[model samples]
Target: MMAGEKNPASCYLDERTFRLCCRLFLQHSETIQDGWSWEQIKGTDEGFMKKTVLIPVQSSVMHKQHGCFMQAENMDHLTDDIQSNVEDETAGVQAVCEIHAVLRYEYHVLYSCSYQIPVLYFRASTLDGNPLSLEEVWSNVHPNYRQRLQQGPWDTLTQQVMCVTS
Candidate 1:
């Protein structure tokens, strides 16, 4: 309910409502922005998948803009390694890519069904998407999120891509 809070469980919308909201938000963003776009694709579940990208303008500081993909997964969808590696106790997962930053970060949120909380499973990397040593990633991430990233796996989900001008 509060704006700009760090907790995902605090999100009032449930999964179905959240997906619908995402679609609607994407539609409005397209009308108001020159370089933002998103589309829904079929999902493993009855829900939908969404991929969004925001390209920067000529005056922007970052030269490259990378597309980010986010999707949710139920407990049954997780791999054995991921299931075991994630320390958080949760019933669902949300995965996201962060290639737009100077360092790439790939993280998953595990939603605790009972508590309605979201726990982060995260890892970061160098600009080329090469896996950083745990120490390296530890130093790069903010102090607040360091614990989550440190507790999670070492793989990154995003790869560098050239900006598309057209």
Candidate 2:
């Protein structure tokens, strides 16, 4: 074995699975234009690395205030009068709000010489430089995938709480 080289017994990731995972991520996020773009970097002795860029997300009126709750004195008379012009007009609110945030997901795929299966390692973070907690990440994931994500045996590297699934 050479320096920086992976052991033959180590389990690594495959190329096809990596590509499929990338496509699935985009499909679920639905905000690809806003971010979630990926780039393939040079391959290392172990395998390949894919980096996903960070994207920002701002809070909306609905998110802040939840929803409007109106009480009418008369059900019959209020029905006709409820058609008043009510503009949410979040321009001013958005200007002063500090709830702006960004999201990014990265993938590292390696080929395991022993197991001979592809191993995928991924990490997600915010633009503020704060790494996301497992719960926070889990909440954003689609329900169908949440169960699998939680059950999967993931290896977390130092400073990065990544989830690795075979």
Weakest lDDT window of 10 consecutive positions for candidate 2: 80-89
Q: Give candidate 2's whole-model lDDT.
A: 0.46
Q: What is the RMSD of candidate 1?
A: 17.9
lDDT of 2 by residue, 25-133 (tens): 7666556432344444567423343445433332321133222222233333332222121122132323222333335555655445566575567777653345666
Kindly report which residue stretches of model 2 are placed more than 4 angstroms away from their true locations once superposed. Answer: 1-46, 53-99, 147-166
Best by lDDT: 2
Cα error, residue 95 of model 2, in Å, equals 13
TM-score of each: 0.30, 0.39
Off by over 4 Å in 1: 1-12, 28-102, 107-123, 141-166
Best by TM-score: 2
